[model samples]
Target chain A: MITVRDLAKHYRVHERAPGMANALRSLFHRKYKTVRAVDGVSFEIGAGERVGFLGPNGAGKTTTLKVLSGLLHPTGGEVRVDGHIPQTRERAFLEKITLVMGQKQQLIWDLPPAETFELNRAIYGVSPADFRETISELTTLLELEELVKKPTRELSLGERMKCELAAALVHRPRVLFLDEPTIGLDVSMQVVIRDFIKRYNERWNATLILTSHYMDDVAALCPRVIVIDKGKLSFDGSLTDLVQRIRPEKRVVLRFDRAVSASEVEMFGKVVERTELSATLQVAQDAVREAVSGALARLPVADLTVESPPLEEVMSELFARSRSEREASA
Target chain B: MRRYARLFAVQVRASALLAMQYRVDFVIDGMLSAFSAGVALIPLFVVFTHRTSIEGWTFGEALVVTGWFTLLQGVLEGAINPSLTTVVDHIRKGTLDFVLLKPADAQFMVSTARFLPWRAMSIVTALGIFVLAFVRLGRLPSLTGVLLSLAMLVAAIALLYSLWILTVSAAFYVVKIDNLTFLFGSIFDFARWPSSLFRGVVGFVFTFILPLALMTTYPAEALLGRLRLSTFLGSLVAAVGFVTFARLVWKSSIRRYTSASS
Candidate 1:
């Protein structure tokens, strides 16, 4: 559904010193550096597949999304969405796609979300019947019954985001480019948004690409993850594959009947977290059975469960590794 | 075209709902519009008392020109002006992404997305003043004169709207210019007085370069049956030229846009 070939978006950013004299000098003769926001990154997204675009700050995830959605013209290479060049922004191409930025909004501020929804309906040329059915479905799914009528400024962030999602989906776009869609929301609200996004993708077979700081959102919605750092593709595969490649270990979490010392748990493997009643240890995946049996036999393990390392740690370690590798190569 | 019309209708409805929410603001805006119009007319009244006409225009003819200026100002403040700073805000804040993503003409969406309905009150006041001037003159315009005047009025609006688009599109490059509309407002103020009031290069600039004099003065002249055919054709050509130039500038600006994300 989307093909990006050696895409690059370079920005000529003005550089200046902090002092007033430098600022004044910049007014006459400015210095600029070309920051490659997205440099020669290539990826293909199949229809109905959900993909997570992962990166640290300044990693070009949002830049790629903007290019795909026709908001920004790519500085080099080519991009096609649903068989149309995005930068041209042909009406047919735009009608099949939607870009939702969590920080920004399309809702008319003083008016209700319903008004913006209707406006989109007109702009997209959606029939009244389809518009009504879509709005009804979205309202029910997003639980926006009372929220849609109130002015957007009166709603909470979560409520407004729910409305934003509804407004974006009023046309039932086939490709969804969500940039930080769950930013700044509480845990449950984030889960709600994540679940709603998944359901929409499943129902419409939409090509979904999401970039989010919240790892949980990515985990819940995207099965395949693409990681980028410093405008270069670092990793692209399943979430499980990413975790396994980065950490190559499992977490052995144990609960005790009584208080236990940290030293006792350290014998099994590397201690990740330790407390009086509960502890977690990082053990090699190959040694998981031996480690669990050792803990069960020696320690008073009331309950024990084995799981993979937390995704956040895995991602952090992956980024740290990438940064060091880049430094080494330089 | 039908789709754009329908979308514009929705924008109007949305703007109207927003206006309804600020009822007190509507009242305040009405009062301010009336007060400004009254204050503007004071200078004209003072000048008329001192002399029967300024240059070759009679007191009634000058009032007609002021009425047309106020009417155009109302249309501008109601629709076009509301989008000026908004375009800058959208560019700076990254909200323009939503506009570009829409399956419509971005320029049309940006131009029509905002309006202040209460500002239309000035148009009504201007009409009242125009009718009063016509009654005082005690002569109705010829049919041809009225037709030519209406055409010129439309051409003037097109020229003004095109100029505004040009100004606002510059925001894409110079994003920090928050009050770019102030420049237009200053230039538009020149439309209140007749072009003949200025002489030499200044008159030439207002008449042909900025075309501020053409906006109101030609329409007034057409209504008074004093407009030359050459001037009428020149105003039409200027309107078309400005609109085409503005559209080209807007397209190039969009192509040059880097968006706010990077």
Candidate 2:
């Protein structure tokens, strides 16, 4: 449903120096540098597929989404969304996609969300019947019965995010580009948003590309993950694959009936964290079963669970590795 | 077009709701606008006090110009200014993505996003003043004169709107040019008087280039029974030309916007 080839977005930003002398000099002759916000990245998304676009600050994930949704004209690249050149932004192309930015909003601030929904209905040329049905379904799914009528400013961030999702989906778009759609919400609210997104994709067979700082959001929603760093494609594959490749160690989380010596757990594997009655050890994936069996017999174990390294740690390690590799080459 | 009309209707309703939320500001805006109109007319009164008429235009005739100026400004402030600034704000803040991703014309969406219904009070007050001035003049414009004036008024409004579009479109290219709109605001202030008052280069610029005076002056002159048919038609043609040029500028500007961060 989406294809991109050698996509790049470069910006010529004015450069200014601190201190009075430099500031005054810049007033007459300002300097500028061309920064590549997104550079030569390529990827394809199939229909009904949910993908997570992961990157650190200035990694160009949001820039990529903007280009795909027809917001930004890529400096150099070819981007096609469901057979439409996004930059052309034809009415047909727009009706098929929706982008939800957590920091910004489309709702009319002073009025009710219903007004914005009505405005969208008119702009999208949605029939009254379909508009009614979609709003009803969205309200029920998001549990937005009382929120839609109140002015947007009165709602909490979580409530507003829910309404924002409802407003974006009023047209039932086929492609969803969600940039930090669950930012600033509590855990449960994030779960609600994630579940709603998955259900939408499943029910409509829509293609989704989501970017969020919250790793849990990516893990629960996107099966495939694309990682970008410094405007380059760093990794692209399944979430599990990324975790496995970045950190090949599994975590053995043990609960003890009595106080356990931290030194005893260290013998089996690298000790990650430990207290009097609890311990965590990082063991190689191949050695995980052995480590668990050893710990079961050695430690005062009451209960134990074996799991892969947390996604957050894996991602941090991946980013750190990429930066170090770049530094070494430099 | 039908969809735009429907969207505009909803925009109006939405703005009405907004106006209700700030009723005090709405009332204050209208009063201030009327007071400003009164202040603007003081110079004209002084001009007429020294002489009953200038170039056959009575003080009452000049009032027509003042009234139309106030009326058009009210409409511009109430509807066009709010919507246009909303466009600029959206562009700067990257919120314009909402409008662009919608299945509608971005220009139309930006042009009709916000409305300040209470600003229409200024238009009503201007109309009252125009009627009062017309009654005091006590010379009914001939049928042709009235028709010509009405046509010129429309052309002038179109001309003004076009100028505004051209000014705001610069934001797409120069993303940080908020003060660019001050150019139009200054030119619009010149429309308070007839274009003929300023001769030579200034007259040529306002009449032919920007067409600022063409919007109010020609209409006011026609209503005052002093407008020549050829001059009125010329102003109408100029207004249409300006609108077309502004549309082309808007298209080019939209092409220049690389969206939010790109």
Candidate 3:
């Protein structure tokens, strides 16, 4: 549904020193440096697939999303969504896509979200029947019952976000570019948003591309993960594959009725964390079964669960490795 | 075109609801606008009291010019200024991404997204003043005069909107500047006077370059039976040319937009 070929978005950013002399000198003659926001990145997302775009700060994930959604014209290369060039911003291309920024809103402040939704309906030329049905479905799923009637400023962050999503989806876009759609929400609210996004993708077979600082959101919604660093593509594959490639160990979390020694926990594998009532061990995936059985038989355990290392750790390690690799090549 | 009209209708309704939410402010705004319109006429009143005419224009004719100025000011404050200012804010805060994603003309959407319906009071008062001036003059405009005046008035509005679009488009490059309308406001102040009051290079620039003179003065001249066809056609050409230029600027400036990251 989406194809990006050698995409690059370079910004000519003005630079100046901090002191008064430099500041005044910059007024006469300014210096500019080219910052490649999105450099030589390429990826494809199939219809109905939910892909998580992951990167550290200043990594160009959001830039890629903006380029794909027609918000920003890429400095070089090409991007097409649903067979239309994004930068052209043709009506048909825009009708098939929506970009929902968590920090910024489309909702008219001091007015009900319903008004913005109606405005979108008219702009997109959605039929009344389809508009009604879509709003009903979204309101029910996002639990935006009375929230849509109240002024947007009066709603809580999570409530406003639900309405924002509803407003974006009024036209039933086939491609959803969600940039941090769950930011600043509590855990349960994040889950609600994540679930709604997944359901939307399933119901419409929409292409979903999400960039989130919250790894849990990415884990819950996106099966495939694309990692970028410094405007370059570093990794692209399934979430499990990413984890296995970066951190090839499983975590055995054991709940004990009483205190346990650190050494006892280390007997199964490397002790990741330990407390009086519980312990965590990072075991190689190949030894997870044996480690679990050994811990259950020998350790003072009440219950246990084995899982992969947290995505945060794996991502950090991956980024660190990529940075060092770049430095070595340079 | 119908879709744009419908979308604008929705925007007007939404903006009206927002205005109603602040009813006291709406009333105060109307009173202030009326008072400003009255104050704007003081200079013309003084000039007329000293002499029955300035530059061969009777006091009644001068009143019509001020009336057109007030009406244009009302429209600018009520619709154009607010919308263009909001575009600046959108660029600074990076909310323009939502606008670009919509399946509509971005320029049209930005230009009509926000309006103060209460500002219509200025237009009404200006019309009342115009009618009162016509009564004082003891003559109704000829049919051709009225038609020509209406055409010039519309062309004036088009010119002003294009100028605003061009000014606001600068936000894409100079993102830190907050008030892009200051230059327009200053030039619009000069527009309150008849273009004939100024001569030589100043008059030429106002009439030809910025076209602020054509906006209010030419329409008033057309209504008072003083407009020449060549001058009327020139204003129309300027209007069309400004609109085209503004669209080109908007198209090019949007390419420089770097949306805020998530």
Top of the candidates by DockQ = 1
lDDT of 2 by residue, A45-103 (tens): 99999999999988999999999988888889899999999998888899899999999
| Interface DockQ of each model | 0.74, 0.73, 0.65
Ranking by lDDT: 1, 3, 2
Off by over 4 Å in 3: A255-260, A296-298, B176-179, B258-262
Task: Give a tens-digit lDDT track for model 1, residues A236-308.
Answer: 9999999989999999999999999988888899998889999999999999999999999998889999998
lDDT of 2 at A298: 81
Better of 1 and 2 by TM-score: 1
Greater-DockQ candidate between 1 and 3: 1
iRMSD computed for candidate 2: 1.8
Candidate 3 TM-score over all chains jointly? 0.95
B47-78, model 3: which lDDT tens digit per residue? 87879888877888888888999999999999
Against the hidden true structure, what lDDT does model 3 obtain?
Answer: 0.89
Question: Which should have the higher lDDT, number 1 or number 3?
Answer: 1
Q: In candidate 3, what are the lDDT values of residues A1-330, reduced to their tens digit? A: 999999998888789989999999999999999899889998888999999999998999988988898877788897888899897889899899999989999899998999889999999999999999999999899988899899899999999999999999999999999999999999999999999999999989999999999999999999999999999999999999999999999999999988887877888998888887898889999999999999889987899898889999999999999999999999
- Kindly indicate the candidate among 1 and 3 with the higher TM-score: 1
